[model samples]
Target: MSVNSQITRTRIMECASKEFMEYGYQSANMRRIAQAANVTTGAMYNHFSNKAVLFDALVQAPAEEMLDRFRGIHAQFKADLPKLTFVHMKETAYLGTDWMLEYIYAHFEAFRLIFCRSEGTRWVSYLEELIAVEERAYCDAFGKRGRRVEDMFLHIIAASGFQYLVECVSHDLSYEKAVAVLDSAKRFSMAGWQELFKL
Candidate 1:
Protein backbone atom coordinates (compact mmCIF):
# COMPACT_ATOMS: atom_id res chain seq x y z
CA MET A 1 0.00 0.00 0.00
CA SER A 2 1.06 3.57 -0.60
CA VAL A 3 1.91 5.85 2.35
CA ASN A 4 -1.37 7.73 1.95
CA SER A 5 -3.34 4.51 1.87
CA GLN A 6 -1.61 3.27 5.01
CA ILE A 7 -2.30 6.55 6.78
CA THR A 8 -5.95 6.46 5.80
CA ARG A 9 -6.30 2.93 7.07
CA THR A 10 -4.74 3.89 10.35
CA ARG A 11 -7.10 6.80 10.64
CA ILE A 12 -10.08 4.56 10.02
CA MET A 13 -8.92 2.15 12.67
CA GLU A 14 -8.40 4.95 15.14
CA CYS A 15 -11.87 6.32 14.64
CA ALA A 16 -13.36 2.85 14.63
CA SER A 17 -11.70 2.03 17.93
CA LYS A 18 -13.27 5.06 19.53
CA GLU A 19 -16.63 4.21 18.00
CA PHE A 20 -16.50 0.63 19.11
CA MET A 21 -15.42 1.64 22.57
CA GLU A 22 -18.19 4.18 22.91
CA TYR A 23 -21.13 2.31 21.39
CA GLY A 24 -19.97 -1.27 21.33
CA TYR A 25 -20.14 -3.51 18.28
CA GLN A 26 -23.88 -3.75 17.92
CA SER A 27 -24.55 -0.04 18.22
CA ALA A 28 -21.45 1.30 16.48
CA ASN A 29 -22.09 2.58 12.97
CA MET A 30 -19.73 2.32 10.02
CA ARG A 31 -20.89 5.61 8.65
CA ARG A 32 -20.19 7.37 11.92
CA ILE A 33 -16.70 5.91 12.03
CA ALA A 34 -16.11 6.97 8.46
CA GLN A 35 -17.28 10.47 9.28
CA ALA A 36 -15.09 10.57 12.34
CA ALA A 37 -12.10 9.44 10.33
CA ASN A 38 -12.80 12.09 7.66
CA VAL A 39 -13.14 9.35 5.05
CA THR A 40 -15.97 8.20 2.87
CA THR A 41 -17.57 4.77 3.09
CA GLY A 42 -15.82 3.77 -0.13
CA ALA A 43 -12.48 4.80 1.30
CA MET A 44 -13.08 2.81 4.49
CA TYR A 45 -14.04 -0.27 2.44
CA ASN A 46 -10.82 0.00 0.46
CA HIS A 47 -9.11 -1.06 3.70
CA PHE A 48 -11.63 -3.13 5.66
CA SER A 49 -14.34 -5.32 4.16
CA ASN A 50 -17.01 -4.49 6.74
CA LYS A 51 -17.74 -3.39 10.26
CA ALA A 52 -17.01 -6.75 11.84
CA VAL A 53 -13.83 -7.00 9.83
CA LEU A 54 -12.77 -3.56 10.98
CA PHE A 55 -13.52 -4.42 14.57
CA ASP A 56 -11.58 -7.65 14.17
CA ALA A 57 -8.67 -5.75 12.69
CA LEU A 58 -8.55 -3.54 15.74
CA VAL A 59 -8.55 -6.44 18.27
CA GLN A 60 -7.92 -9.82 16.64
CA ALA A 61 -4.14 -9.97 16.90
CA PRO A 62 -3.90 -9.00 20.54
CA ALA A 63 -6.91 -11.06 21.52
CA GLU A 64 -5.61 -14.17 19.80
CA GLU A 65 -2.13 -13.68 21.20
CA MET A 66 -3.45 -13.30 24.75
CA LEU A 67 -5.60 -16.41 24.42
CA ASP A 68 -2.69 -18.36 22.97
CA ARG A 69 -0.51 -17.32 25.89
CA PHE A 70 -3.17 -18.47 28.34
CA ARG A 71 -3.48 -21.79 26.57
CA GLY A 72 0.27 -22.34 26.76
CA ILE A 73 0.33 -21.42 30.44
CA HIS A 74 -2.57 -23.73 31.20
CA ALA A 75 -0.89 -26.57 29.32
CA GLN A 76 2.21 -26.10 31.41
CA PHE A 77 0.17 -25.96 34.58
CA LYS A 78 -1.59 -29.17 33.69
CA ALA A 79 1.68 -30.94 32.94
CA ASP A 80 3.11 -29.91 36.29
CA LEU A 81 0.03 -30.80 38.31
CA PRO A 82 1.36 -34.01 39.82
CA LYS A 83 4.48 -32.30 41.14
CA LEU A 84 2.92 -29.01 42.23
CA THR A 85 2.91 -28.20 45.95
CA PHE A 86 1.05 -25.23 47.50
CA VAL A 87 4.06 -22.95 47.21
CA HIS A 88 4.70 -24.07 43.66
CA MET A 89 1.05 -23.56 42.78
CA LYS A 90 1.06 -20.04 44.23
CA GLU A 91 4.21 -19.15 42.33
CA THR A 92 2.82 -20.55 39.10
CA ALA A 93 -0.44 -18.69 39.55
CA TYR A 94 1.38 -15.41 40.14
CA LEU A 95 3.57 -15.94 37.09
CA GLY A 96 0.58 -16.74 34.89
CA THR A 97 -1.45 -13.81 36.16
CA ASP A 98 1.44 -11.42 35.78
CA TRP A 99 2.05 -12.55 32.22
CA MET A 100 -1.60 -12.06 31.38
CA LEU A 101 -1.57 -8.59 32.95
CA GLU A 102 1.42 -7.66 30.84
CA TYR A 103 -0.36 -8.77 27.71
CA ILE A 104 -3.39 -6.73 28.65
CA TYR A 105 -1.25 -3.70 29.29
CA ALA A 106 0.40 -4.07 25.93
CA HIS A 107 -2.93 -4.26 24.14
CA PHE A 108 -5.03 -2.20 26.47
CA GLU A 109 -7.55 -1.06 23.90
CA ALA A 110 -8.11 -4.51 22.43
CA PHE A 111 -8.80 -5.90 25.89
CA ARG A 112 -11.04 -2.98 26.77
CA LEU A 113 -13.01 -3.86 23.69
CA ILE A 114 -13.08 -7.56 24.43
CA PHE A 115 -13.94 -7.33 28.11
CA CYS A 116 -16.05 -4.20 28.27
CA ARG A 117 -17.11 -3.09 24.79
CA SER A 118 -17.86 -6.33 22.96
CA GLU A 119 -21.39 -7.01 24.13
CA GLY A 120 -22.83 -7.43 20.64
CA THR A 121 -19.85 -8.97 18.91
CA ARG A 122 -18.88 -12.63 18.71
CA TRP A 123 -16.17 -11.71 21.18
CA VAL A 124 -18.82 -11.21 23.81
CA SER A 125 -18.46 -14.85 24.78
CA TYR A 126 -14.73 -14.52 25.37
CA LEU A 127 -15.09 -14.21 29.12
CA GLU A 128 -17.40 -17.21 29.32
CA GLU A 129 -14.94 -19.24 27.29
CA LEU A 130 -12.14 -18.26 29.64
CA ILE A 131 -14.19 -19.18 32.67
CA ALA A 132 -15.08 -22.48 31.05
CA VAL A 133 -11.40 -23.23 30.61
CA GLU A 134 -10.83 -22.42 34.27
CA GLU A 135 -13.74 -24.65 35.21
CA ARG A 136 -12.27 -27.52 33.25
CA ALA A 137 -8.91 -27.05 34.89
CA TYR A 138 -10.49 -26.93 38.32
CA CYS A 139 -12.45 -30.09 37.63
CA ASP A 140 -9.34 -31.88 36.45
CA ALA A 141 -7.40 -30.94 39.54
CA PHE A 142 -10.09 -31.27 42.17
CA GLY A 143 -12.52 -33.80 40.74
CA LYS A 144 -16.31 -33.25 40.71
CA ARG A 145 -16.53 -30.88 43.62
CA GLY A 146 -20.09 -29.58 43.50
CA ARG A 147 -20.53 -27.95 40.13
CA ARG A 148 -22.57 -25.07 41.55
CA VAL A 149 -19.97 -24.04 44.09
CA GLU A 150 -17.17 -24.55 41.60
CA ASP A 151 -18.88 -22.34 39.06
CA MET A 152 -19.67 -19.71 41.64
CA PHE A 153 -16.07 -19.45 42.78
CA LEU A 154 -14.69 -19.42 39.27
CA HIS A 155 -17.14 -16.81 38.06
CA ILE A 156 -16.67 -14.50 41.03
CA ILE A 157 -12.89 -14.61 40.98
CA ALA A 158 -12.74 -14.17 37.21
CA ALA A 159 -15.20 -11.32 37.29
CA SER A 160 -13.27 -9.63 40.06
CA GLY A 161 -10.03 -9.84 38.10
CA PHE A 162 -11.63 -8.52 34.96
CA GLN A 163 -13.34 -5.75 36.89
CA TYR A 164 -10.03 -4.71 38.37
CA LEU A 165 -8.60 -4.48 34.87
CA VAL A 166 -11.55 -2.48 33.65
CA GLU A 167 -11.13 -0.06 36.50
CA CYS A 168 -7.45 0.23 35.79
CA VAL A 169 -8.18 1.24 32.22
CA SER A 170 -11.24 3.37 32.83
CA HIS A 171 -9.58 5.33 35.57
CA ASP A 172 -6.18 5.56 33.91
CA LEU A 173 -4.31 4.06 36.82
CA SER A 174 -0.53 4.21 36.71
CA TYR A 175 1.29 0.98 35.88
CA GLU A 176 2.76 0.66 39.36
CA LYS A 177 -0.58 1.30 41.00
CA ALA A 178 -2.40 -1.12 38.72
CA VAL A 179 0.13 -3.84 39.35
CA ALA A 180 -0.04 -3.26 43.07
CA VAL A 181 -3.83 -3.55 42.97
CA LEU A 182 -3.67 -6.65 40.83
CA ASP A 183 -1.12 -8.27 43.15
CA SER A 184 -3.34 -7.66 46.15
CA ALA A 185 -6.33 -9.05 44.31
CA LYS A 186 -4.34 -12.12 43.28
CA ARG A 187 -3.30 -12.82 46.86
CA PHE A 188 -6.89 -12.45 48.05
CA SER A 189 -8.08 -14.75 45.32
CA MET A 190 -5.45 -17.33 46.21
CA ALA A 191 -6.45 -17.14 49.84
CA GLY A 192 -10.07 -17.71 48.89
CA TRP A 193 -9.11 -20.71 46.81
CA GLN A 194 -7.03 -22.20 49.61
CA GLU A 195 -9.78 -21.70 52.15
CA LEU A 196 -12.43 -23.10 49.86
CA PHE A 197 -10.45 -26.16 48.85
CA LYS A 198 -8.59 -26.58 52.16
CA LEU A 199 -5.35 -26.64 50.26
Candidate 2:
Protein backbone atom coordinates (compact mmCIF):
# COMPACT_ATOMS: atom_id res chain seq x y z
CA MET A 1 0.00 0.00 0.00
CA SER A 2 1.95 2.96 -1.21
CA VAL A 3 0.88 6.24 0.39
CA ASN A 4 0.97 7.83 -3.02
CA SER A 5 -1.28 5.10 -4.37
CA GLN A 6 -3.68 5.50 -1.47
CA ILE A 7 -3.90 9.26 -1.87
CA THR A 8 -4.31 8.99 -5.63
CA ARG A 9 -7.00 6.32 -5.44
CA THR A 10 -9.02 8.23 -2.85
CA ARG A 11 -8.81 11.45 -4.77
CA ILE A 12 -9.91 9.94 -8.06
CA MET A 13 -12.84 8.06 -6.54
CA GLU A 14 -13.99 11.10 -4.57
CA CYS A 15 -13.99 13.26 -7.68
CA ALA A 16 -15.27 10.54 -9.95
CA SER A 17 -18.19 9.73 -7.68
CA LYS A 18 -19.27 13.39 -7.74
CA GLU A 19 -18.96 13.44 -11.53
CA PHE A 20 -21.10 10.36 -11.97
CA MET A 21 -23.73 11.68 -9.59
CA GLU A 22 -23.93 15.05 -11.31
CA TYR A 23 -23.70 13.86 -14.90
CA GLY A 24 -24.64 10.20 -14.65
CA TYR A 25 -22.61 7.25 -15.90
CA GLN A 26 -22.66 7.97 -19.64
CA SER A 27 -21.59 11.55 -19.09
CA ALA A 28 -18.98 11.13 -16.35
CA ASN A 29 -15.66 12.53 -17.49
CA MET A 30 -12.26 11.19 -16.58
CA ARG A 31 -10.76 14.60 -17.29
CA ARG A 32 -13.15 16.20 -14.83
CA ILE A 33 -12.25 13.66 -12.17
CA ALA A 34 -8.58 14.23 -12.76
CA GLN A 35 -9.00 17.97 -12.52
CA ALA A 36 -11.19 17.77 -9.43
CA ALA A 37 -8.78 15.38 -7.76
CA ASN A 38 -5.86 17.67 -8.56
CA VAL A 39 -4.15 14.79 -10.27
CA THR A 40 -2.94 14.54 -13.82
CA THR A 41 -4.95 12.36 -16.22
CA GLY A 42 -1.92 10.10 -16.28
CA ALA A 43 -2.04 9.85 -12.50
CA MET A 44 -5.70 8.83 -12.58
CA TYR A 45 -4.90 6.19 -15.16
CA ASN A 46 -2.03 4.94 -13.06
CA HIS A 47 -4.50 3.58 -10.45
CA PHE A 48 -7.40 2.60 -12.69
CA SER A 49 -6.96 1.14 -16.12
CA ASN A 50 -10.13 2.80 -17.42
CA LYS A 51 -13.37 4.44 -16.39
CA ALA A 52 -15.13 1.11 -16.48
CA VAL A 53 -12.61 -0.38 -14.09
CA LEU A 54 -12.92 2.60 -11.75
CA PHE A 55 -16.71 2.32 -11.83
CA ASP A 56 -16.45 -1.37 -11.14
CA ALA A 57 -14.31 -0.62 -8.09
CA LEU A 58 -16.75 2.04 -6.94
CA VAL A 59 -19.63 -0.43 -7.13
CA GLN A 60 -17.71 -3.28 -5.59
CA ALA A 61 -16.35 -1.44 -2.58
CA PRO A 62 -19.72 -0.77 -0.99
CA ALA A 63 -20.99 -4.11 -2.25
CA GLU A 64 -18.15 -6.02 -0.66
CA GLU A 65 -18.77 -4.20 2.61
CA MET A 66 -22.45 -5.08 2.56
CA LEU A 67 -21.68 -8.66 1.62
CA ASP A 68 -19.38 -8.92 4.58
CA ARG A 69 -22.13 -7.66 6.89
CA PHE A 70 -24.75 -9.95 5.38
CA ARG A 71 -22.40 -12.88 5.59
CA GLY A 72 -21.87 -12.10 9.23
CA ILE A 73 -25.63 -12.15 9.77
CA HIS A 74 -25.91 -15.36 7.79
CA ALA A 75 -23.36 -17.00 10.02
CA GLN A 76 -25.07 -15.77 13.18
CA PHE A 77 -28.53 -16.66 11.90
CA LYS A 78 -27.43 -20.14 10.94
CA ALA A 79 -26.57 -20.61 14.56
CA ASP A 80 -29.82 -19.01 15.75
CA LEU A 81 -32.97 -18.43 13.79
CA PRO A 82 -34.12 -15.66 16.13
CA LYS A 83 -31.50 -13.46 14.51
CA LEU A 84 -33.38 -13.58 11.22
CA THR A 85 -36.52 -12.06 12.68
CA PHE A 86 -34.30 -9.69 14.55
CA VAL A 87 -32.80 -8.36 11.35
CA HIS A 88 -35.76 -8.82 9.06
CA MET A 89 -37.68 -5.63 8.31
CA LYS A 90 -35.83 -3.76 11.01
CA GLU A 91 -34.22 -0.30 10.92
CA THR A 92 -31.34 -1.56 13.02
CA ALA A 93 -29.90 -3.18 9.91
CA TYR A 94 -29.39 0.24 8.43
CA LEU A 95 -26.40 0.84 10.64
CA GLY A 96 -24.48 -0.07 7.56
CA THR A 97 -26.82 1.78 5.25
CA ASP A 98 -26.42 4.88 7.39
CA TRP A 99 -22.69 4.59 7.20
CA MET A 100 -22.91 3.91 3.50
CA LEU A 101 -25.16 6.90 2.85
CA GLU A 102 -22.45 9.09 4.31
CA TYR A 103 -20.44 8.28 1.23
CA ILE A 104 -23.17 7.17 -1.14
CA TYR A 105 -25.68 10.03 -0.85
CA ALA A 106 -22.96 12.45 -1.87
CA HIS A 107 -24.80 12.40 -5.19
CA PHE A 108 -26.17 8.87 -5.28
CA GLU A 109 -23.38 8.27 -7.75
CA ALA A 110 -22.35 5.07 -6.03
CA PHE A 111 -25.95 3.99 -5.64
CA ARG A 112 -26.70 4.59 -9.30
CA LEU A 113 -23.51 2.88 -10.29
CA ILE A 114 -24.52 -0.33 -8.54
CA PHE A 115 -28.30 -0.19 -9.03
CA CYS A 116 -28.53 0.78 -12.67
CA ARG A 117 -28.94 -2.10 -15.11
CA SER A 118 -25.25 -2.11 -15.83
CA GLU A 119 -24.45 -3.47 -12.35
CA GLY A 120 -27.54 -5.55 -11.56
CA THR A 121 -26.17 -8.82 -12.80
CA ARG A 122 -22.99 -8.38 -10.85
CA TRP A 123 -25.03 -7.53 -7.77
CA VAL A 124 -27.28 -10.55 -8.22
CA SER A 125 -24.31 -12.81 -8.66
CA TYR A 126 -22.72 -11.47 -5.50
CA LEU A 127 -25.93 -11.71 -3.50
CA GLU A 128 -26.89 -15.05 -4.99
CA GLU A 129 -25.09 -16.68 -2.11
CA LEU A 130 -27.15 -14.74 0.42
CA ILE A 131 -30.24 -15.28 -1.71
CA ALA A 132 -29.54 -18.99 -1.50
CA VAL A 133 -29.77 -18.80 2.26
CA GLU A 134 -33.14 -17.06 2.09
CA GLU A 135 -34.25 -19.49 -0.60
CA ARG A 136 -33.46 -22.34 1.75
CA ALA A 137 -35.56 -20.62 4.38
CA TYR A 138 -38.42 -20.42 1.90
CA CYS A 139 -38.02 -24.06 1.06
CA ASP A 140 -37.92 -25.08 4.67
CA ALA A 141 -40.90 -22.93 5.62
CA PHE A 142 -42.79 -24.06 2.57
CA GLY A 143 -42.10 -27.70 3.30
CA LYS A 144 -43.21 -27.35 6.88
CA ARG A 145 -46.35 -25.41 6.01
CA GLY A 146 -47.17 -26.86 2.56
CA ARG A 147 -46.53 -23.56 0.78
CA ARG A 148 -45.59 -23.96 -2.85
CA VAL A 149 -44.73 -20.43 -3.86
CA GLU A 150 -40.99 -20.36 -3.43
CA ASP A 151 -39.92 -18.87 -6.71
CA MET A 152 -40.20 -15.21 -5.86
CA PHE A 153 -39.90 -14.88 -2.11
CA LEU A 154 -36.51 -13.31 -2.48
CA HIS A 155 -37.78 -11.03 -5.19
CA ILE A 156 -40.64 -9.92 -3.01
CA ILE A 157 -38.29 -9.25 -0.17
CA ALA A 158 -36.27 -7.09 -2.48
CA ALA A 159 -39.22 -5.21 -3.93
CA SER A 160 -41.41 -4.96 -0.89
CA GLY A 161 -42.10 -2.04 1.41
CA PHE A 162 -39.16 -2.85 3.65
CA GLN A 163 -36.84 -0.95 1.34
CA TYR A 164 -39.29 1.90 1.01
CA LEU A 165 -39.69 1.95 4.74
CA VAL A 166 -35.98 2.30 5.16
CA GLU A 167 -35.58 4.98 2.55
CA CYS A 168 -38.33 7.00 4.14
CA VAL A 169 -37.00 6.54 7.62
CA SER A 170 -33.59 7.59 6.44
CA HIS A 171 -35.14 10.81 5.28
CA ASP A 172 -35.97 11.82 8.90
CA LEU A 173 -39.43 10.35 9.02
CA SER A 174 -40.15 9.14 12.51
CA TYR A 175 -40.02 5.42 13.15
CA GLU A 176 -43.59 5.69 14.28
CA LYS A 177 -44.57 7.15 10.96
CA ALA A 178 -42.48 4.77 8.93
CA VAL A 179 -43.33 1.72 10.99
CA ALA A 180 -47.00 2.61 10.89
CA VAL A 181 -46.68 2.06 7.16
CA LEU A 182 -43.99 -0.58 7.32
CA ASP A 183 -45.93 -2.83 9.65
CA SER A 184 -48.83 -2.78 7.28
CA ALA A 185 -46.41 -3.39 4.48
CA LYS A 186 -44.89 -6.29 6.39
CA ARG A 187 -48.14 -7.76 7.68
CA PHE A 188 -49.95 -7.54 4.39
CA SER A 189 -47.14 -9.21 2.55
CA MET A 190 -46.47 -11.67 5.32
CA ALA A 191 -50.16 -12.44 5.69
CA GLY A 192 -50.61 -12.94 1.98
CA TRP A 193 -47.63 -15.23 1.89
CA GLN A 194 -48.65 -17.05 5.00
CA GLU A 195 -52.13 -17.51 3.61
CA LEU A 196 -50.63 -18.76 0.38
CA PHE A 197 -49.30 -21.69 2.38
CA LYS A 198 -51.41 -21.36 5.55
CA LEU A 199 -48.43 -20.52 7.71
**Number of backbone collisions per candidate, in order?**
0, 0
List per-candidate RMSD values in Å.
2.6, 5.7
lDDT measured at residue 177 in model 1 versus the true structure, 0 to 100: 85
lDDT of 1 by residue, 21-119 (tens): 889898999999999999999999989998889989988898888777787778887888877777887898788778877878888888888877887
Once fitted onto the true fold, the runs of candidate 2 whose alpha carbons sit more than 4 angstroms away are 1-5, 71-112, 116-133, 150-184
What C-alpha lDDT values do all the predictions have? 0.80, 0.58
Best by TM-score: 1
| lDDT: worst 10-residue window of model 1 | 140-149
Model 1, position 186: C-alpha lDDT score: 89
Highest-lDDT candidate: 1
Task: Evaluate candidate 1 by giving its C-alpha RMSD to the native, one decimal.
Answer: 2.6
lDDT of 2 by residue, 25-82 (tens): 6777799899999999998898888877877777777667665766565455445543
